[model samples]
Target: MRTRAKLSLSLTVVAMVLGFMVTLQYRQTLLARVSDVTASYTDGRQKELADKVAQLERVNKDALKRLQNLNGEIAAYEKESAGADAQLTSIQQNLSRYRILAGTTPVEGPGISVTLMDGQYNGVGSVSDYTTHDWEVNYVINELFTAGAEAVSINNYRVVANSGIFCIGPVITVNNHRLVAPFQIQAIGDPAVLKGALEMQGGILDLLRNVEDIKVSAVKVEQNIQMPAFTAAVTAPPSEGAAQSTKSSEGKQG
Candidate 1:
């Protein structure tokens, strides 16, 4: 009986020890897993913060660069403005002198109204000898200048020496300016001379009618046309007035 009791006690003790060892091992494993998770979370958070800081730095750098560029641009614009104002003052004084010198800008009186429409003459195949709007305008302007026109305008767009005429599809531009036709050309000169140069009864009119069958109209009228004076750039100084003023000052001193 005694031996059996001791054997039962030893068995209980062995079971308890086995249970304790198992609990300790489980606790260590759980602690290791929790530690790994905490480290990973901390690492992820740190990386996120670092990336945000880097992005902010980049944005700040870009903003600073933009601000510097804008400041530089503002300084340049102010300098340019000052120079332009000085130039403008110098120009206004000179223009006053030119107006006096020209006595009067050219005025339109008793001029002919010449209309040159698009040419349409087909020779062979489907190809027609139709003149484009450009050709007609060019030919008319050239003919007008040859015909001694002081000034000319097409569709009220002034045809100056430095005028720009460009074509985009069916539309035509004058002075980088667009307009729709039929083109109205106003030439300020002797109507008789212009008419003679264009369609002198048996000149270009007869030739166009017989050769190409193109139509051109020239009619004489007593009328007035005036072209606006171009805005002058500030380079050429006032010649006569300044000289006169200087001479008058000299005379006064004498």
Candidate 2:
């Protein structure tokens, strides 16, 4: 009976030891599983953060490219605007010069004036022979131009490229207006040069005094000579289509 009791106690101790070892092993396995899950979650979070940073970098790059394109467009527009302003200024300057040359604008400068009259009634020839003819008036005008006259007028009638000078039944007609002697011929130029040209030996003045037996006063240099714009009609009548268009516009306004 003592031997049997000793065997039973040994069996109990062995069973208890086996139970403690099993419990320890189960706890260790559970701890290992928890560590694996935590590691996986950390790896996923790191990957997500990296992907987000890459996406932001791409967005920033695209935005910078768009900004560069916008800057280039602005520079091009500024250059084009500057070119247009310069072109407009050049066109205005050319138009002003053209208007001056066309004699459509008034002018003022220093010049010379001369008076011409019929020869003194020395009863030697016909009355018409001693009279100042239209040709003689034209001759003086031609001489003034040859002397570098910029503008000229007779009795305040501005002489232009299309001006007409002829005789209308014993009366001299300049631009269709009657002009009698002592014809006042005014020219705009350098005062000294004009005087020199006309008063030169055997010049227009000398020829008129000797050959034509006409009275020509000394050239008078003026400090200021005002010339009016050509008042004669210049523009032609509008075409049929243009006239209709103008009429239509007027009707609309009415």
Candidate 3:
């Protein structure tokens, strides 16, 4: 009976030790599983944060590129605006110059003045031969233009591209206004060239001097010759037939 009790006590002690080992092993397995889950969660969180950072970086780079493009566009617009301003200023200056040349604006400069007078009627020839005609006035004006006269006036009347000189009876009309003897002509140009052109052999001045009934004189050079602006209403263009009739009338009058 003692042998049987000793064997039973030994079996009980062995069973208790086995139980303690099993519990320790189970706790260790549970702790390992928890650590693995925690590691996976931390890894996932880090990956998500990294992806968000990369996305923000891309967005920021795109925004910077767009901002740079906008700056370039603004600079180009400013440059274009500056060029347009310069062109506009140049155009305005040219317009002002053209207006002066068109006689729309009054002008003053150094120039020459010509005086023409009718000789005393000696009763030696026809009345027309002793008087100045519109053709003669037109000829003198044409010569002045050929000599590079920038501006011209007949008896204070501005002579523009469409100015006309005609005769009414014995009186000569310039710009549709009656102008009597001693017709004064003012021209703006190089004084030396103008004087030389008028005084040249067989020139307008010389031809007038040769005529027994016409007297010609020139100022040669005069400073500060002011020219008034053209003030007459523009005449409409004449039809072909009307132009022919007018030419025929002028010829007969001449």
lDDT values for all models: 0.58, 0.71, 0.69
Look at candidate 3 and give me any clashing residue pairs.
none
Candidate 2: lDDT of 136? 81
What tens-digit string does per-residue lDDT give for candidate 2 at 1-254? 99999999999899899999999999988786768645565787776887898998799658656655764575466555556587765765565456545655556789999988887654345545423456787788888888888877776656654444542211234444455667888889999999999999988889988998888898999999887555454443466798788877896774
lDDT of 3 by residue, 48-121 (tens): 98789899979966865675577457556656555658776566556646756756556778878888876664
- Across 52-155, the per-residue lDDT of candidate 1 in tens digits comes to 98999799668656755774575566565556587765765555445423322223455666655545533232312223445556666777778887667665
In order of lDDT, best first, we have 2, 3, 1
Candidates by TM-score, descending order: 3, 2, 1
Question: Residue 32's C-alpha lDDT in candidate 2?
Answer: 68
Model 1 spans > 4 angstroms off: 1-108, 119-131, 164-179, 205-213, 228-254
Least well predicted 10-residue stretch by lDDT in candidate 3: 167-176
Once superposed on the true structure, which residue ranges of model 3 sit more than 4 Å away at CA?
Answer: 1-85, 121-131, 167-177, 235-254
Name the weakest run of 10 consecutive residues (lDDT summed) in model 2.
167-176
